[model samples]
Target: MRVLITGVAGFIGMHLALQLLQRGDEVVGIDNFNDYYDVRLKESRLQRVVDADTAGKFTFIRLDLADRAGMAKLFAEEGLDAVVNLAAQAGVRYSIENPLAYIDSNLVGFGHILEGCRHNGVKHLVYASSSSVYGANESMPFSVHDNVDHPLSLYAASKKANELMAHTYSHLYNLPTTGLRFFTVYGPWSRPDMAMFKFTQAILAGQPIDVFNYGKHRRDFTYIDDIVEGVIRTLDHTARPNPEWSGMKPDPGTSKAPWRVYNIGNQNPVELMDYIRAIEEALGKKAELNLLPLQPGDVPDTYADVDALVQDVDYRPSMSVDEGTRRFVQWYREYYKV
Candidate 1:
C-alpha cells in the first residue's frame, strides 16, 4: 500500500514510517520541521529512517499541515491508499501558554487532512487522539466509551474536535476513520518536551528534575514500538459501522457510520516516582529532586482501558515500564554521548 504519514520527523511518526517501509509498503512522509522542539532531533530521526530504507520504499517531503493549498496539491498527486496523521501541537502545558498553536496545528491542520482524505478516495484514515481527552473524568481506567466532552486544555479539546470532525467525514463520505487515543507515549527519539526525555536529560546533566504532582501521578506510559504496532493494525482494519450501535444510548467510541476510537496504551499504569527511579537506575545517576505541583492542563493520572483495541485488533501493548525506560535512557546516552 502507498501510505502518506504526516509528521514523519516526529518520534512516533518516524517509527511508524520506518515500520511501514520495512514491511514492503511505499511511504510518503511530510513534516514542517517546526521549532516546537529541537529540529536537530527531528533531522536525526529522519536520517535514521532514510538510512534504514535500503529498499528505497520511502519518500520524505517537507510540508506543514496548515498549508491548505500545499496539502490539497499533495493529496491530488500522491494517490494515497491510506493515511496516518500523527502531527499536532503536542504539549499540554504548552497549550496553556500558546493556545493559538493548538488551533493552527491541531484544528485547522486536521481540517485540511479530512478534506484531503475525503477527496482522494483514501481507504483508511487513522489519526492520533489523546488520553488527555478524558480530562476531569477521574476514571480509574479511561475507556473509549466514556464521555470526553470536558477536556481541560485546548490540546485535549482540539483532539476531541478532531474526532468529531472525522465523524462528519465518515458519515458524509463513507470514509473509514479511526482515532487512537494515545496515552503517555515514550521511547527512543522522543520529543524533548516530554517528561521522560526531560527527566533523563536532567539526571545525566547532574541537575534537579522536577517531579510533578509530587511524584504521585500514575501514567500508562505506552512504548513507541507498541504504539506503532497498534497504529499499523488499525490502519489495516478499516473501520466499519457498529451494527449494535443505538441512537438512544449512543457510544462515544463507535458510530453507526464508519468511525471508531480506541485507546492505544500499555494497560499497566506506573507511578511517576517508579518511572523516575527506572531512569535513575538505567543511567546509574541519582537525580536531585524538585517536587512540584501538577502544572495547569495536566492530569493526576492516565490509565487507558485498551479493551476495545484488543477486541478489534487482537493486540495489546505488553512493554513493561522498566524495560521501556531503560531503552529510552540507552538511546539518550548514545545519542548525546553522555
Candidate 2:
C-alpha cells in the first residue's frame, strides 16, 4: 500500500513512517519541520527513517499543511491510497501564546487534508486527536463515548474541532475517517516540549524541574510504540458505519457516517510525582523540586479507557510508566550526550 503520512518528521509520525516502510509499504512523508521545538530533533528523526535499510520505500518532502496549493499538488500527484494526518501546532501552553498557529494548522491545514483525501480516492484518513479534548471532565477513565464539549484550552478546542470536521467529511463523502485521541505519548525521539523530555533535560543539567499542579497531576502516558501500533491497526481497518448508531441518541465515538474515534492510551494513569521519581531513578539523581500551580489549558489528570481499542485491534499498550520513563531517560542521555 502507498501511504501519505503528514508531519512525518514528528515524534509519532517518524515512528509510523518507519513502521510502514519496514512492512514493504511505500511511504511519502511531508513536514515543514517548524520551530515548535527544535527543528534539529525533527530533522534527525527524518534522517533515521531515510537512513533505514528499507529507506528506498520512503520519500520525504518538506512542506507545511497550511500550504493549500502545495498540499493539493501532493494529493493530485501522489494519488495516495491512504493518509495519516499527524501535523498540527502541538502544545497546550504554547497555544496560549500563539493561538493563530493552531487555527492555521489544526483548522486550515486540516481542512486542506480533508479536501485532498476526499477528492483523491483515498481509502482511509486517520488523524491525531489529543486526550486533552477530555478537558474539565472529572471522569476516572476518559472514554470516547463521553461528552467532550468543554475544552479549557485553545489547543483542546482545535482538536475537538478536528474531530467534528472529520465527521463532516465522512458524512458528506462517505470517507472512512478515524480520529485517535492520543494520551501523553512519550519515548525515544519525543518532542522536546513534553514532560518526559523536559524532566530528563533538567535532571541531567542538575537543574530544578517544575512540578506542575504542585505535583498532583496524573497522566496516562502512552509509549510511542503503543501509539504507533494503534495507528497502524486503525489505518489497516478503515472505519465502518455503526449499525446501532441513532440520531436520537448519537454516540460521539461513531456515527452513520464512516467515522470513528478511539482513545489510544496506556489505560494506566501515573502521578506526576511518581513520574518524576522514575526519572530520578533512571538518572540516578533527584530533581530539585519547584512545585507550581497548574498552568492555563492544563488538566488535573488524564486516564484513557482503551477498551474499545483492545476489543477492536487487540491493542494493549502494556509498557509500564516506570519502564517507559527509564527508556526515555536512557535515550535522552545518549541523544544529548549528557
After superposition, candidate 2 runs with Cα above 4 Å error: 53-55
lDDT of 1 by residue, 142-187 (tens): 9999999899999999999999999999999999999999999999
Q: Give a tens-digit lDDT track for model 2, residues 1-338.
A: 99999999999999999889888899999999888888899889988998883547787888999999999999999969999999999999999999999999999999999999999999999999999999999977999899899999999999999999999999999999999999999999999899989888887888999888999999998999999999999999899999999989988888999999999998889999998898899989989999999998898999999888887778788899888888888888898888
Model 1 lDDT-worst window of ten: 203-212
Q: How accurate locally, in lDDT, is each candidate?
A: 0.94, 0.92
Clashing pairs for model 1 are none
